[model samples]
Target chain A: MDWQKLISFITVLVTLFLIVRSEIKKYKLRKTRPCGSDCNCAVLKEVSLKKLK
Target chain B: MNYFAIIGNPNCGKTTIFNELTGLRQKVGNYPGVTVEKKEGKILFKDGTEITLLDLPGTYSLTANSPDEKIVSDILLRKRIDIQRPEGIVCVVDASNLERNLYLVSQIIDQRFPLIIVLNMVDVAEDTGLIIDVGKLSKLLGVSVIKTVGIKRKGIDELKRAIQGKFQVSTAVRQWKLPEIVREEHEELTQLLIKHNSVKEDVAVYDAAALLSSPKQLKEFKDELKPEILDHVLLDHQRLESLGYDRHSIFVKSRIEWVRSICSEVVSIGEKKKSYTDIIDSIATHKFWGYIIFLTLMILMFQSIFTWATIPMNFISKGFDWIGYQLGALIPHGDLHDLIILGAVRGVGAVVTFLPQILLLFLFLGVLEDTGYMARAAFIMDRLMNKVGLHGKAFIPMLSSFACAIPGIMATRTIENPRDRLVTMMVAPLMSCSARLPVYSLLIAAFIPNLLVFGFWNLQGIVMISLYMLGLVMALLMAFIFKKTILKGKTPDFIMELPPYRLPSLKNILIQMWERSVLFLKKAGTIILGVSIILWFLATYPKIENGNPSEKLAHSFIGQAGQFIEPLMKPLGFDWKIDISILSSLLQREVFVSSISTIYNIQNADDKTVSLKSQMQKDLDTSTGLPRFTILTAICIMVYYVLAMQCMSTLTVVKRETNSWKWPFFQFAYMTGLAYLVTFIVYRVGLSFI
Candidate 1:
């Protein structure tokens, strides 16, 4: 394939991968952990300590 | 290797000290089975002995009321397998508030670990006319105490040396005498724990006290400890409560007394210093002036985002245009050239041109936070939040949502009420994030007049503010409705400390700005790049055998699809092209801008460098024989975007945050339905007038 076609194919594949990877990971995590309604890990603040000093 | 922990009360500059000691050498991971982050760093001594420093979550005490506090308690109690128990503890304290801050120190010292107390923010204490005798305090607590201003990096060398030196276990365990009954109960628990092998024989007295004091602590060790051991602890707890000796209060009272005794011995006050921070707080948290100031600041921030980013956006747009023009000339006029020019470059450029505005928004946020004003903003918004049925703390996450909903939704962790947190997460995306800026800017620039509202105010900036406020108004309205009906719960009180005001460090603000902007640019390069190519292919395929290149777009798959949906978009003044762009926007909101650019580039292959704005302005409606982008149409589109759930990534994040398909789907349905209704109203209303 030409560079244009080659680049377009790779780009499409990468975008699909980026979108799919997170969904699958989140799916597995939710299924396995099932931390009730209150345990949304995404909202957890990633701080070196509590509150930004 | 020696393991050490840095523990402190909130806002005592513990994080600053950790950053100084670690300096970009720390790893952030989640504590096992909990979402709270676990931070660990390596500190190398001159003698080549390495110390692993764990920055425990800052809590007032080790009582474990919150998940973060539980993580700290577990590590200190040697109950976590993910982290090793520290051999020594660096108990950071705020010297300015020694009486209150030392409460946690009393608890830490009870652990009987080799401890060093770094009295942080000594400069603030000295400014407040409080003189603390470091040697005397150290002697009283029976631990080494070093005074340091964490921000100024003063006394750091001494602190490092003290950490490496021969460590001494604190005598506070012996000094602060517990009640005879409680002491007897603590010993019985320790013996029981050791007998059950739930705890080592060398367990600290405080850890034993924690077992009897906190019911949560027993639950944490439920699998390890025998049922009878837990029953016995609960039995002791009941016995203490029945005898009018509340274990929790008794422990708290003893710690407070210990802290007060140490303060009286080592600290002297020359005068009660009056604070400028107090004066500022009075105004910033005032009932009336605070709201006015907040609104004015928000208006100014939005105005600057629109005005300041224009020049850089223009430069980026032009640079991309010039490159596309060059590529068009160098490459042969074929499918390959068209794909490169229309598919990738224009798509990325459409999103990236808005980076300057994104960076400026984050810069202002960093400043507000660093100056200790963000907490006050939350305080001011608390009463208003209560009116809308959300806890006052919901304002912080909603404010964060103005930047991005992912982190904003993530910030809901601070909210204690599950229903309040869910409501906040569901409505967070209604806050107009930086991603929506490009669409609003483009539509406003194309259709809205650039004239001033008065003699001085820019009309365009006012429109930008209106668009943002539209989102805010809708968010509050939806939060109110949801809280009252679906996710009903009592509003929790917002309790937070207001840190002393200090000059914001320019380095930290710039670093924050860079990180946020880089994340936006990365999306442009990766996700937008891919989507654009897919869109280009759809818009260029199934070409007619003998058609003009410009007309070939109408014959392509995308054009047919757009036409198929054209009737649905007709009432909102959107044509086939706009319909296609809207469809593409489902992946990402900013993709709408790029999709339009790609479509126009494909149609206007003859005119290479004409800007997308002029093309949008010149686009004509076939039936009305008038320009397609009218003031009414632009307003309708902006209104639509303000309410639409266009970005798929946000939905995924919502799913992850809510941990169910139910909430994300409801969010998507309600938002899309609201967008259509509002857009129809705005469009119909505008058409009636003009």
Candidate 2:
């Protein structure tokens, strides 16, 4: 493969990794943490859980 | 530096005061374990001391009825481990509603924190012919009261002075006493708390009163208390109720009485004249006229977003072309150049061009919200929302959804009922957000006839409005169905305070617009940048040897995927190229226009100047050999977007909001299914008629 192709490939991989990283982090965090407020409404619960941690 | 918290009722101008005091020094984050905003800002005292102000969520009382109220309760009780107990308190009360506003003040007095009462909206109170004696009120409550009009910056200096002054430890702030039975229970709980070292000596009384008064508020100290202790508290609460005085009424009735007594001494009316807001609300809230006014306002908003944004959008489109040309000259024409020009610049251009409409949408929304008409709109829509098993409070969130669903979903925190909030969250994405504008406009310009009705009304404008209204009607209908089916529950009775109308502050509107634009750009920089490059790689790889570039693209990875999905989209009148755009755009709706631009190999790819539109119009179907896009096809595409949850960011937020994969995936499935079914019928029936 040419140098251009190599750089482009690496960038795409990095981008994909970053995107997937956020989703996975959220998933792991959601499982471990309970929401701070006792309200049963889950609106923004992931962020709420993250804040609690 | 010390920490102080600003708490007040909703629509009591608490935010206005926060903004005036802090100006641009504010930082916003979610409160611990909740989506409620934790706004912190720094204020420098004249004596060179600094104070950090935390703007807590507006609450009616210390009672933890909602998540927002719980946050306030937790913070004031010093239960949250992440935050320190604030050194002082600024209780913002509306002078116009002094009696009700003082109810919160009385509760705060029970805590006996260093307190200052900020009587906000004193001008409004005066206009209503209600004169408030701030000094007398302060004397009676045994606290410092500063009268300020937050929006006008009136008495702000005095408020600052009061905050800097040494707070007094008053012995007489708690005027209302509990009944003999409840007082005995409170003392027993206080003794238990002190014995167990559950609270400090001073906090024992407040904690005991809170725990005995409302058992649910004990959740604030769930980590520290044993199960048996909690059960004991509940048992005591039941005993108090069994002894004939209800816990809620015992607290509420005494508090109301205290507030009334204070107001009677310090408040008087000069005259009771009908204010301008009263005159306006008569028509704006009228059953028939209200609906008409609302429809007219929505139509005007949609029309402006469609027609007024065109000039700047064209300019933004051309700006991208100029950048592309400059890059062509500066960089050697190769894979790097192609990727930068086609993938990055064009992708950014597509998203940036939607800025004008987004700003306009926020501009109108800010005006509605700032003028207090947004609450009125909700009040009017509550009757209809009731029919759909949704509360009227859901209307503000749904209205916000028209701008974008992220904030709209976040706004669902205002809806107290869990089920209703979830249902609102589910249907919010069905509102045609600004991201969908580029897709609709592109398809409409390419396919829909530009004929004007009666040589006056533009057909394209009407089509745009129809698409928006279609989303609204569908969202309401689906919300109704969802409420009846999967998320069925009792819709809470909506109680909203309608603040008097004021002219929307131009500075606030501009600041809101600026913030939204920055958020949009931030997304473009991060998620869109990543998605754009990845999609470009997918569309460019697996090159064909010694063939036409278009033919080479056909064999690319994304091209192959599109072809794989072609059969499924055939009923909706979408070709493989359109199908590919649909797949890529699931990450973001605006990506559809850019992905199509990249696939078609249009250099500038501006939707204006007829380049992209003409390309789309002349494109032929491989099988039918007819123009790829028709009026029917455009309608079908728009319908699909109107129904589909084609935004990953929205879904991520949904997962966060619902705290489960069950709801977001269910949202994806139901919205996608409905989109496909509706598009299929629209396309098939239209083909037969045409």
Model 2 pairs whose backbones collide:
A42-B657, A44-B657
Error of 1 at B137 (Å): 2.4
Q: lDDT at B568 for candidate 1? A: 92
Best by lDDT: 1
> Per-residue CA lDDT of candidate 2, range B443-555, in tens?
87678777777776678878988998898888899999998888788887877777788888777778878877887787677767777787788888887677666667778
lDDT tens digits, residue span B502-525, model 1: 788676677778767766787787
Chain B TM-scores across candidates: 0.90, 0.90
Clashes of each: 1, 2
**Candidate 2 chain B — worst ten consecutive residues by lDDT sum?**
B25-34
Q: Which stretches of candidate 2 lie over 4 Å from their true place?
A: A1-53, B25-35, B46-48, B177-197, B200-247, B272-274, B451-457, B602-610
lDDT of each: 0.76, 0.76
Native-structure RMSD, model 2 = 4.8
Clashing pairs in 1: A43-B410
How does model 2 fare in lDDT? 0.76
Candidate 2 contains a number of clashing pairs equal to 2
What DockQ results do all the predictions give, each relative to the true complex?
0.14, 0.19
Query: Highest DockQ: which candidate?
Result: 2
